[model samples]
Target: MREDTKYALITGASGDIGREIAIALAKQGFHLYLHYNRNEKAIALLQEELVLFGVDVIPIQADFTNSDAISRLQDSVFQLDVFVHAAGNSYYGLFQDMPDQEIANLWDIHVHFPMQLLQKWIPKLQRSDAGRIIFISSIWGEVGAAMEVAYSAVKGAQIAFCKALAQEIAASGTTVNVVSPGMVDTKMNHLFDEEEKTALLTDIPMHRFAKPSEVGEVVAFLASDRASYMTGQTMRLDGGWFMR
Candidate 1:
């Protein structure tokens, strides 16, 4: 790797939103560490696509549910110029009916694993002149959702974590921010059919879902020198759903 080259590790890079964010960062001239849990095929294809941009792309597998994965991740990457935590799943069910294991998994994947990565990579990021940490948070983190109680809790934890960490690391020249998207058209919404989607659309002022590329572009910007002064902010990518 070239000494002048920059590295970005994006968790959940095989997913729709995370894939777009990886591509966008590749376009920004970043060598990428694409992290995916079990989707080797998807990560392979994404790695090929990212390589087209003339930047180094490496695919890594680590299940966030396992504590061992965090150790493996820490051993895999030495220095990180950018870190984007896009790894998480949505829980869509009644809170009372949810199992303890499900809630634990939600907190593990959404909070604990991310905290471990941030803690591990923060020092490496501090060494870079343009370090960036971005979390793909959700509108549920702010106003939250009805059936997504556990999901909302974890996402809310992520936002709070980013806010506090950003303040703590500001003088290190690293910027931390959250891109809390509203209703994005990703696999996470697969549970909702056209009818359900239509009903959900009624709540959004834009009457539509945001494209993955839209969120990706904002992430790219945040990772760039352009967003240097911006940190500790939750930039809602929601189409006026939870405007504050």
Candidate 2:
């Protein structure tokens, strides 16, 4: 690693949106710490592709559902400039039908574990000249989704956390923000059938779901020095759907 190489730790780097974020950062010459729970093959493939960008790509695995894994993840990272929280799962069911264990799993994966990891990594971020903390939240976090109540709650929590943390660390030159994308065209949205997707399109003025690369580009900008002055703000990438 070069002395001036910037390191970015992206959780869920094997997933669709996460993979794009990793690629965007790599294109900007960032050494990547790609974190994944399972899908070793996906991470391996992504690692192979990222190396062409001439940046070091290190893969780290940790099940976020298990809090004890946080320590291991922290130990794996040496230096950090950006931390992107993109690891999450969405539950599609009525809030009442959701199981206690599933709710706990969502909370642990989306909020609790990430918070603990940040607690450990914040110091390293502060040491850097410009540090960025970004959360890949959802449009549902801004406008509640009926069946995804729990998912919306956790994402909303992420937004609140970002705003508060940005305030706490702004003096240190670290910026925290949320990228709440609406109806991203990823495998995650495959749960919606054709009819459902069509209906969703009608709501979005752009009449289309956002591409993963679009999300990645916005994230890349946030992680860059250009976004240094922008913190505690939510970048709504929802194509005019549920605009606030």
Candidate 3:
């Protein structure tokens, strides 16, 4: 909120990676604008933890699928130094088996929300001395996954948005980039059995799945001045899962 200070707006802050990023950024003396769609309990505990770090943590709720909620959020946070669009959902099944509405839902959450947020944040960020915009995409976005057509499409859209936005914001000292993580160990994939997990690991050079904190650390780095020259690129933290 202060010009002499920095603030981070992290969406999907209730999730594993998002929560880790919130903690890491808080430790870095960042005022946090944490957004969560549901799970108030997790958000409450996270708010308490962030406050323990002696930083301001504001927990807000917004359904990425809703345009009205997003507009309200943009109005609430007039200016932000950093933004991480990490809220997304996926359904794993045959493309033909998935409902049409499911595909639309993924597009709204993964594609439309990030685009709209950037449309609102970019100008404000341009007014700042420096700013960072990070999009959490996936390896599937880079190389399409067989059963994740809609998810992959949305992720791919994010990647495209990052590249184009990077070029648009470069002259303004605002960086836009994408971070694509591969097969992260999150509750979303807890449905996998041991054999399924092992099967997924066998293809990866790093046999073990990546921890959420591992991805968060990279995000913190990018949000820092260290990545000043880095823009228009999608950095993959996939543990050798996708060589791209």
Best by lDDT: 2
List candidate 3 segments past 4 Å from native. Answer: none
lDDT per residue as tens, model 2, 158-233: 9999999999999999999999999998998899999999999998899999999999999999999899899999
* Pairs with backbone N, CA or C atoms under 3 Å apart (clashes), candidate 2: none
Give candidate 2 misplaced runs (Cα > 4 Å). Answer: none
- List model 3 lDDT by residue over 159-192, tens digit each: 9988988887799888988889998999987878
Considering every candidate listed, which one attains the maximal TM-score? Answer: 2
Please report, as a residue range, the 10-residue window in candidate 1 with the lowest summed lDDT: 235-244
- What is the Cα-based TM-score of model 3? 0.97
Evaluate all candidate structures by whole-model CA lDDT and list the values in order.
0.91, 0.93, 0.87
Q: What's the best-to-worst order under TM-score? A: 2, 1, 3
